[model samples]
Target: MSTIVFLHAHPDDEASQTAGTMRLAADAGHRVVCVYATNGDHGTLPTDLAEEETIVLRRRAEAEASGQVLGTARVAWLDYADSGMTGWDQNGHEESFHAADLDEAAGRLAAILDEEDADVVVGYDWHGGYGHPDHVKVHHVARRAVELAARRPRYLEATMNRDHLRRIFRAGVEAGLFPEDEGFDPDRPADDGNPIGTPEAELHWHVDVRPVLASKRAALACHASQEDVGWMLGMPEDQYAMAFGDEWLSEPGRPEGIEDGLPF
Candidate 1:
């Protein structure tokens, strides 16, 4: 069976962006592995933490649980601290993924790719979905790791279709699910001063993951420590499916129009 390794910026990212894809891969009997670049130390503070528990430790456990929900064979972390948003003071942390040496970080991921013998390695688009510092770093690291690794895995950059998201957002506003003054415009500059995702015309793959949508939602549920997960899980079933029923991807240097389903 082919092995697919999903490289993500933080612990819960796999659940957000690639859980459906991972579920599909695992169900097809492929070995699915997840590697996170940071410990997500800067995520929302959980209220139920034990006295001695740290956010990093809690995030790590949540990530492990998320992997279990997706049927991931293994979960690995690079151990870098989370670089909170673009301008947050946490960005200056010496050990944050954003502040880590690029080559060193790539080497760490390359080591895992080598060990897994990954036939396919999935990472983020150039804009990193929403352009968080660590997410942008993940884009760079994923590309460099493939080059530095012994196994030259097929690289697929996972992303959202910005056009699709815009349409959905407009629909939500019209349906009163979102306030017109909500100020969440997809056209607005994100954390990196660019729009959220690649335009649909530039995409290469449109993976219909609706069949595995339940598993994707469940995977997100595994990250219950994050307040955002609660918001996502509370969405009406139809609305949730409309928002995340498909996953999009781009291949390096490929100019091909979007094709249906996972190519590898």
Candidate 2:
């Protein structure tokens, strides 16, 4: 069986963007692993955390639980501090992922790619899907890892379909079910000053993960530390499925079209 490696920016990121795809790959008897870029040290402070549990500790524990839910065989961390949002003070910290040496970081990730003998490698879109420093760094480091690794895997960039998200939002608004989410303008610049995601015309793969959506939600639910993820979990079942049932993807430099599955 082929092995697939998913490289993500933070803990809950895997759950949001690639869990369903990971689960599907596992279900087909392929090996699936997750490599997180940071320790998520800057994650939201959850009131429910135990007094002894630091954010870093809590987030990694959550990541392990999420991996279990997603059927991931192994979960690894790059061990860098989370680079807070685009303009946060922590982005400049030496230990922050944003500031890490590119070759060094890519070398670390490439080690895993080599170890796993990854057949398919997944990372984020060019703008890291929303432009968080760590996310954008993920794009850069993953690409560099692609160059560093001896294993030649098919690389797929995980991304949302902007047009699809807009359509969903519009329908929700028309039905009065979803008020314009405050501060969320799909057309407006996101953390990286880029729009939310690539246009549908530029999206290449549309993996129908609805069959595994339950596992995806379960994975996301493990990261209760983040309010945004919790809010996502609160959506009605059908609505949640409607929003997350399909996991969209793209190739590094490919212009877009219909591709049914990851390269085998």
Candidate 3:
């Protein structure tokens, strides 16, 4: 009977990061809402676009489709321009999300939380799980929004289990789960030259979403414009289930976990 709101950096973030949790939330009869900080204007443009089609518009549709698959009660966009990768020229763009004032952006999210009467608010981890500037900004903005909102909703941050990921990658290799030349080194530093995800010790919850794994994979497919998420979409159902069977989250400022998934 609670309302949960997920604040993400872009269109597909909802799918890549928390689709399973969102699906589980909705199936449990909770009101699940998603608010994106940007329209994903910088994402890969589909090759089949009509003469008048635009990346912004296309990404919007994709997000909406993704929302549908995830069973989100509502989906909203903040309409900020995407701030591309760490050093891309778009990072300095005036309309980029990273350029927006923190309080101002946080206020926007706070408005949604208030409107939705949100009982739980979820955002990205401190390093954004890979350090994209806009994602990192989401962490800060969601934290600030918690202060700006009137509700004392549970605040959780989504993240990956780095140790678990390494194990999965290695196990996949040993089992010949992936093509040999995949060259995916789990230990390699992600966008920020830092290893991906938080250590298992830092995670507060490990949500087994395998029951809703199909919904999660289907939702990820709706984001056709994101190349980074494509690998997941192309994965076989069993492989996808095995890899994305669980989601991880942590409570803000609490060294020890308060409780499992969404603190529910």
The regions of model 2 sitting more than 4 angstroms off are 180-184, 253-255, 261-264
Give lDDT per model, in order: 0.90, 0.87, 0.86
Per-residue lDDT tens digits for candidate 3, residues 168-248, read: 877877887866587766568988898888988888887888888888888878887778888888888877876888799
TM-score of every candidate: 0.96, 0.94, 0.94
The residue pairs that clash in candidate 1, if any, are none
Quick one: ranking by lDDT, best first?
A: 1, 2, 3
Write the residue-wise lDDT of candidate 1 on 1-264 in tens digits.
899999999888898898998999899899999999999888899999999999999998999988898999999989899999989888889999999999999999999999999999898988788889899999999999999999799999999898998898889888877667878777789888998898999899988999999999989988988988888899898789888898999998887698998767
TM-score, model 2 to reference: 0.94
Query: Which 10 successive residues of model 1 have the least lDDT summed?
Result: 176-185
Residue 200 in candidate 3 has what lDDT? 84
Sorting all predicted structures by TM-score, with the top scorer first, yields 1, 2, 3
> What's model 3's TM-score?
0.94
Q: Which stretches of candidate 1 lie over 4 Å from their true place?
A: 174-177
Model 3: CA > 4 A from native: 179-181, 253-262
lDDT of 2 by residue, 203-242 (tens): 8888888888889999999998898897899999877877
